[model samples]
Target: MGLDAFVYCRCWQDGLTPPAPVGPVGFDEEGYLSLVVSGGGYTETDAAFDGWTASACPHELMEQASEHLSNWTGHRLFQQALGAAGWSHFPALQAELPSANGGRMPAEAAVRVLDELDYFEQQAVIDDEVVLVDEATEAVALRYVAAYEGVLMLGPGYRAGVDPEGFFILDPDSDPPATLFRSARFRQRVLPSGQVQFSDEKKSVQIAMSPVGDKGTPPEWLRLEKQHQAPAEFGYIVEPLRRLCRAAVATGNPVMWC
Candidate 1:
């Protein structure tokens, strides 16, 4: 089985845009000859969707009627509520959230976090530790540990929607502690069962993570793992990706956890 996807590209831009596709994350549009480098594998089609989104596109366009007219007060409240609802998704890092981040959160809270990004000012940084803060509430939403070379795929549920509306990216003050990047070292050992594992003694934990949207989305990277197992292999890569596509459509939500 294999994955099929369209890559978006934009012309006339320089450098990696904020939230650059350093890994398998998806983009919202597709074009050819992008001015910026898109992280995912690309096809020969003269199209790419990996770049900084423009105001003209529906994905980046903000509704003027959104309740966040003045500052990010309204949106901030929403983000906090959402974070609370999704708290269970982030493990080992939950307690570290409130003080280091914002505070302890419940899995089902109504607090919406960063619902409208326009109210918040944004900046770009490379290979640095950045903090995600809700400007209105002064809450630290999340932290990103980046590599000077590129980004690593972020955790699931960091992005939980099809519109790519609720995601935020933050760089850390320094490289993430050793435990974060530890997983990459073991990637070289692809086991016979196709399952991979990382060992603390053999790997450093300092990893770079980027929040990516749902799978099967148009512009994100769709990795085709087992090309020869499509029709007959029930548990093959093709069926799994197809299942992801169907799930995305049925839910009307991006497979945000991918």
Candidate 2:
């Protein structure tokens, strides 16, 4: 069996308790404004919840959205390009060129060329290499090799600031406002038996409204959307959840996943 994921928003009140796991529930387009259990339970039952609710988005949808969002929102365009070239998987390339230091030119030299040139300009230098497979794959491999070399230049902490959390938060009222989009806060919990769970405690959950396109959206995120050619192709999947978030925020309710 695969891991289950859920996304819902509940109204906030001073003494309200968290929603109990009554069983499986489905949310529709209008948002699950009222909680209804199949076994004939009152809307105010301890197990049921009030306020806006959206159908739970699939875990895979969240994962894909996060990946695309990262790629589009990140300022490191070169690194993104390198990733497209498969740099993380294959870092070395076979080429026939002499090194400036003396023997055959190593992968390091190819990387330097990549950093110094734009996409089109790098093609001239790459043309001299021995055919690795096909022209397209070889070109991508060469770029990856270059990216690896560039990372080496940054020293040990090149990746130190990378966010380990997997989800992005979108709070608009933050001090700087833009700070909300800076890092991911969603994290995975590892069980003693080595099983992994993608869930968070109520206290740890951060507040964020969905990026459903509005004037309230942060400028930085809007630019990313334009730059990446509307990278949020899967936005529809999260629309309901976004609506739920809006309702929760309006009612001062907390959103949680189980």
Candidate 3:
């Protein structure tokens, strides 16, 4: 029901085998290594796609980057990069989209979010306390709190997206008081059913309330055993997808994110 990625490569011609999933959420550690870490799951071959190829090359690429990247890419450079990619599939993604990601293709919005990656960061809400160790990471988290001050992920949509963890990355001044609710203590909880619940219980009754994105909280990091430093903006998502695109170009294969 959620998004996953794959590489439709001719390399899978020999004997396509999708990385076996050990759990419903994802595959085992080794599967992640091949499917995502290296972005290479099959041996390269000169052979072309034939009657033997699997739709996904039996290996995944990304787990959903969310719709953030492409929608945020209303910026200049990302549009340029897509046009330059020489892949019409990418260029078409830049066209006016529908309701999913503010009139942008899911993939295209992903590109924009990741365009200014140097500014992105990743933080986690441990036990429901947005906790991050590094200076930059903490700064971004603090910025979202409005009580403190962040975003490469900043903009009109800033408040709607960031919680303690969503952006730990949007510029601090974007719309703080509204972005992170009223305080760091306002926790976002993930139930065993994998559903998210963000407590809007304000840190201060005096502070006015703003709406939160229904699916803003990152669904995966809820169980993080340790603080994960994704540093700066939405770059974490952008970089992986960019790599996939590069891989696609280099191998003349198709990039599949669904």
Candidate 4:
């Protein structure tokens, strides 16, 4: 996920000492170079470039740079990668609920989305629940969340299955369903009978991949920021909060939302 190269600050078009590569540069499908940099840390833009009078850099610049890099490549590597990884464009299952926005989403339209996904992937039952898998999962999931405004779910007893079409959609209602994808886009499909099914030309076995790998626990400092609200009073701890913020900024991943 990290890039194999680096670029210096002196080459930043401004006459200033550049900051070191804070993280590895990652390649999108188009091969554009990208790396995370400390926005608040000293950079070429900081006056004096880290001298006694240097001003702290702003964190927003890192975001700006990331956006720039995405276009710089002009290649959809990020998107391609996700698709290659078999991610969904949005979570595929929803609970039966009224459309709060008062807009009705026809079931046929939802089925069409599934139909398109069918040609690209496979479906299988993992731990006794059905799910979809394919090369496009990662790309699909990434864009799906961003485009559809969705969240990832985790837990036991979640069923994974092919969403009627060849695409993957987690059916939470199935016995032993491992996860359920909830999104506004799928809200209209939630019917009072809770019966949802689509047609697919093919079905096959699937393998699910978790971004969080099977591994040891992260350091306490890393954990603090990664799971900010988990323990509840994360912000009240000044030193930890400062350290986490500094760490995020330093790594080009400042917790702006947090």
Can you tell me which runs of candidate 2 are displaced by over 4 Å? Answer: 1-229
lDDT measured at residue 223 in model 4 versus the true structure, 0 to 100: 10
Tens-digit lDDT string for candidate 4 (58-114): 323222222111221111223222243344542321211111212222233334334
lDDT of 2 by residue, 73-138 (tens): 221332334344445332421121111112222223334323333232232211121111112122
In model 4, what lDDT does residue 185 have?
19
Question: What lDDT does model 1 reach?
Answer: 0.26
What global local distance difference test value does model 4 have?
Answer: 0.27
Q: What does each candidate score in C-alpha RMSD?
A: 23.3, 25.0, 16.1, 21.2
Model 3, span 1-258: residue lDDT tens: 222344334333333444333212222232321322222443332122221222334333232222223433222223333333333443334442222312112333434433433222232111222332223223222222222332323344333333344332232455444334333334444556543344534432211222222235432222111233223233534555566544544444444543
lDDT (C-alpha) at residue 257 in model 3? 41
The candidate that wins on lDDT is 3
TM-score of each: 0.16, 0.18, 0.27, 0.19
Each model's lDDT comes to 0.26, 0.27, 0.33, 0.27
Q: Give the lowest summed-lDDT range of ten residues in model 1.
A: 62-71
